[model samples]
Target: MNILKKVILIDDDQINNFVCESIIKNERFAEEVQSFEWAENALDYLKNTAVQQPEAFPDLIFLDINMPGMDGWSFIEEYKQIPEEVTKNCCLFMLSSAVDRKDIISAKSLKEVKDFFSKPLSPEILSFIKEEFICS
Candidate 1:
């Protein structure tokens, strides 16, 4: 079963968002890609959306670690406000350039984040995502 479908991209970096969105779309990995420049807006979207219907909602989320405010870390903390269904079925990956071991450890601690990948995202990363989350 193809698990990649509607996806949300939350990153303050415009280039990162553009590149990832382009890659995801060009590869037909996600049918829809919604982007947010900050985690706060992304959170607000999640908070208002009905994710219980997994087939109709976003299948995954790509969150960025470094942002002006409400970074990926902060967003994860506030993600508790979102419905449990949203957290259960959908996948969330931490896409960042941070090579810091501490950051890696921190991301691993978050139950919502399925994988921590360093950017810029390539075909291999995309494939891994598909194999791990989409096909699993």
Candidate 2:
């Protein structure tokens, strides 16, 4: 139940990805965090293009709202293509800066989404996960 033992991030923004990668690496929140600049690549990896055995079954996902072609919404929609086993183990967090009430409501409503938080993921959140799940 170590929550952040593995993490996968799908964001097109280089800065966001870089910042998050730095934070996770520096804080040791996760054993590893595999980041993808393109959602399609992430999706393809999720489907079958990347890991042959899916060892990257991330316990958490930091998903962004806006991207080039495959936006967060599109990514979630296509996520259904993944077999239920993989999807079931993944807990998604809508880690975006979108403050729109509609977006918040939609994220809250989604069964896949564990929570929604604005940008700049913090170590406190990571610590909380570690305490809540990892050290349980």
Highest-lDDT candidate? 1
| Model 1: lowest-lDDT 10 consecutive positions | 48-57
Q: Model 2 misses residue 87 by how many Å?
A: 1.7
The Cα error of candidate 1 at residue 54, in Å, is 6.8
lDDT of 2 by residue, 15-115 (tens): 88888988888887777788998889888877882246665667788899888988999999888777777678777888888899899899879888877
Off by over 4 Å in 2: 1-3, 49-51, 131-136
lDDT for residue 85 in candidate 1, whole number 0-100 = 64
Error of 1 at 87 (Å): 2.4
Candidate 2 has a TM-score of: 0.86
Candidate RMSDs in Å, in order, are 2.1, 2.6
lDDT scores for all predictions? Answer: 0.83, 0.80
Number of the top TM-score candidate: 1
Residues forming the 10-long window of minimal summed lDDT in candidate 2: 49-58
The parts of candidate 1 lying over 4 Å away from their true place are 1-3, 51-55
